[model samples]
Target: MSTLPAYVVFGEALTDFIRQSDGRWAAQPGGACWNVACVGVRLGVAAGYAGSVSNDLFGDALYMLAAEAGLDMRFTQRFDAPPLLAMVPSTQPPEYFFIGEGSADLRFDPDRLPVGWRSAAQILHFGCISLAREPLASKLVEVALAAHLAGKRIAFDPNWRNLMTHAAYRDTFHVMAGITDYLKVSDEDLQHLFPGINQREAIAHLRALAPFAQIMVTRGAAGMSLFCDGIEYTQPAFPVTVADTVGCGDAAMGGWMASLLRQPDAAPATHLRFAAATAALVATRTGAYAPCWEEVSSLLAQQITESPHAQ
Candidate 1:
């Protein structure tokens, strides 16, 4: 039998049709949770993905991409439903349009999960549209709660989208937040949850819900902040030439989990620093590809040389 994965991600796997300003388009296979699994694999973590993929060309490509990234697909489901599509504007976040009412990625069946999968993984990651809609949404919660009860760490990155009704988002938010062991939230995600609030207030709100969870809030260019057990740590973003912002947060979350899993005794500050460096490297490139460990180290070395106090 094959070795079990250390990390398992449950979410959607879909395509993004990014429209360029010059009338060209690029189709990419990316979903927030899918990115976490792929990036974790690329960062040398044993990761598995539990999501639905259509049997279409795009779905085939995404499946191959996951395989290439060294992710275990034993729990991946395939269906006849068409792949989900998103219209990504060059200047704005991607706007999703479900290709078919019953898309493959949204058809995840919790009852059909691989036997012993709960004990096979050390951590279960959740986020994105998988937590927003129907049967799948409820199923995801059921699985997450099971994992938590089984003593597996739960990592979440809400990756909130307006496509989900405010009520749905609120409910999902509280349920996951209550049980999350490691959480990655963005300023944007918080703003959507609590309108017109500043970062401190947002953190306070999240802390009240998940008091013991190690929460990391990504603050774009200003960098990220960490809160755990009444203590807070902040780290500035690594200085890097910008390429595009695509997959930046996913990379950071992936790196953070990878670092923590490997060095369980490391401080939260150490984890955030490594994660920030990984995110900076991804920002210096295009697409959702993960950076090699050396790449992140080299960037960190340079940052340390340039700014003695950095990281």
Candidate 2:
């Protein structure tokens, strides 16, 4: 069997401090792009991560984790600064407080892109806080536009956080959306981006902005909907025990990307089943934990048996 095509994931890898019930804090390796890349590698895809990190211990841990996850670390750059940290309150839904100013992740320069990286990757996936920031945001847009012109697929998950309602970040959001080939957003994201607009209207509005892009809107627990090739697909979220929702969506994105890479002509139902199952499995785990290939394969097989359209 031929090896699957590789994917290049661009963005940050930082530690998240989640407030515990015991009046303490626990730190875990996170960053959406990092989780997605790790999950991709676990699912048997050759994945590469491109970004910068601080010389601190937390950053070193992220580097080691990426290496252990089988991701190519050749494009990663390091600096003497401390890694960015996010403080998650116990009551709210994953709120982040970026600690470092001009952190290493934002120091990426387009000229430093690894040799032949752009041409070698089948898909370039990026998103989350990286798209809402300054120097990094501009750099990412440059890289994405270059990749698109080179004929590589661009997968974007706005992963729009509620904190990005500011004027500057909102403008960058639209700019990034314009260059995407595949986009994933949540129902909350739709309303946040376009206040007072109905779901259908938001879809139409986004479609008009990126006419050539295929869009997927995830409605937590309820289901997810995908608009592609002049058609729409709505699939229910898999029923499973919830632990923490941190990496669930990233797992789904990895599954969808993996399926598309393997079977580019697969039906919408196939994509949804694979994505929803992977997401469900991830939700049962803690903090950005990625599922192995065996786990995803089992889920896919079970889904096929349970869903008549999962062929």
Task: Identify the runs in model 2 with alpha carbons over 4 angstroms from their true place.
Answer: 1-5, 303-311
Please report, as a residue range, the 10-residue window in candidate 1 with the lowest summed lDDT. Answer: 302-311
Model 2's alpha-carbon lDDT is 0.80
lDDT of 1 by residue, 221-244 (tens): 988888876777788888789898
**Superposed Cα deviation of residue 4, candidate 1 (Å):** 0.7
RMSD of each: 2.2, 2.8
- Among these predictions, the greatest lDDT belongs to 1
Q: What is the lDDT of residue 52 in candidate 1?
A: 89
lDDT of each: 0.84, 0.80
- What TM-score against the true fold does each predicted structure earn? 0.94, 0.92
